[model samples]
Target: MPITTSSPPIRQPCPPGTCICNRDALLDNPAADPRILLLTQHEEKRLLARLENCASLDDLRKLQQRMEQQLGLRTEITPGHNEVRSMRGIRIVVHEQDGLCRKIRQSIPAAIRRGLERNPEVAYELLNEHDLLRGT
Candidate 1:
């Protein structure tokens, strides 16, 4: 069985601010071109580290803002929270820190992937080669 890709590459003019990754190159040769993976891994570490060190809501907000500026993502901090009911309708309190953690886990990977798609070169520079981790 062959892997079939469905989305046809659009040849129409690229919008002014869009940068399309040469996905064909990436898909054809991943390990041979280690840049994209390295970049993504680095961004993931940076974002996760920042998220972990957030001491308060304000700190989290600042980190989220920085992420937004860097990657065009708006971190939605639903302050003064409420309860999320489970499938069984049991209300689970949403603590601010827990919410922040959830956001970090979800957003960091997304931001990393977006960063890779946009700027793999920077990503590779930021990551450690032997470990695939973020380089300080």
Candidate 2:
């Protein structure tokens, strides 16, 4: 004897105001923003430490790649052409569509200032090694 298959049941729409089917409509709206992830203090410290350890532009590039992979943050670094090799520009790209990029960008300077206050030696080392003191 051959096995037989039965047709699957059809989905029926919920009656008006009877179900929460309209919840999906909220997702369809264009104005809805993507969820943003705010970094904790510990995470920010870790990021700063990693940045402080960058000895060269190549190291910074590697750190940038690691940040993208680990934290979903896109970092762009522009090298300066001065007596000391320094970062001409540093910015976080909002390519992930998350709203955290702007906050992170705003907080970076303050974080760096705090870190420098805590340990000026490390900051000096970073400046001497990677020329990351001028524009950044």
Q: Which candidate achieves the best TM-score against the true structure?
A: 2
Clashes of each: 1, 0
Taking all chains together, each candidate's TM-score versus the true structure is 0.34, 0.41
**Candidate number achieving the greatest lDDT relative to the actual structure:** 2
- lDDT by residue for model 1 (29-136), tens: 645432222224456577666655544445555765675554444444321223312111211132222112343345554543454335444334333332344445
lDDT of 2 by residue, 20-63 (tens): 42323433666743222334546766777766555544565577
Off by over 4 Å in 2: 1-38, 80-96, 109-136
lDDT over C-alpha atoms for residue 22 of model 2:
36
lDDT of 2 at 56: 49
Worst 10 residues of 2 by lDDT: 85-94
Taking every candidate in turn, the Cα RMSD to the unseen true structure, in Å, is 18.8, 13.0
After superposition on all CA atoms, how large is the RMSD of candidate 1?
A: 18.8
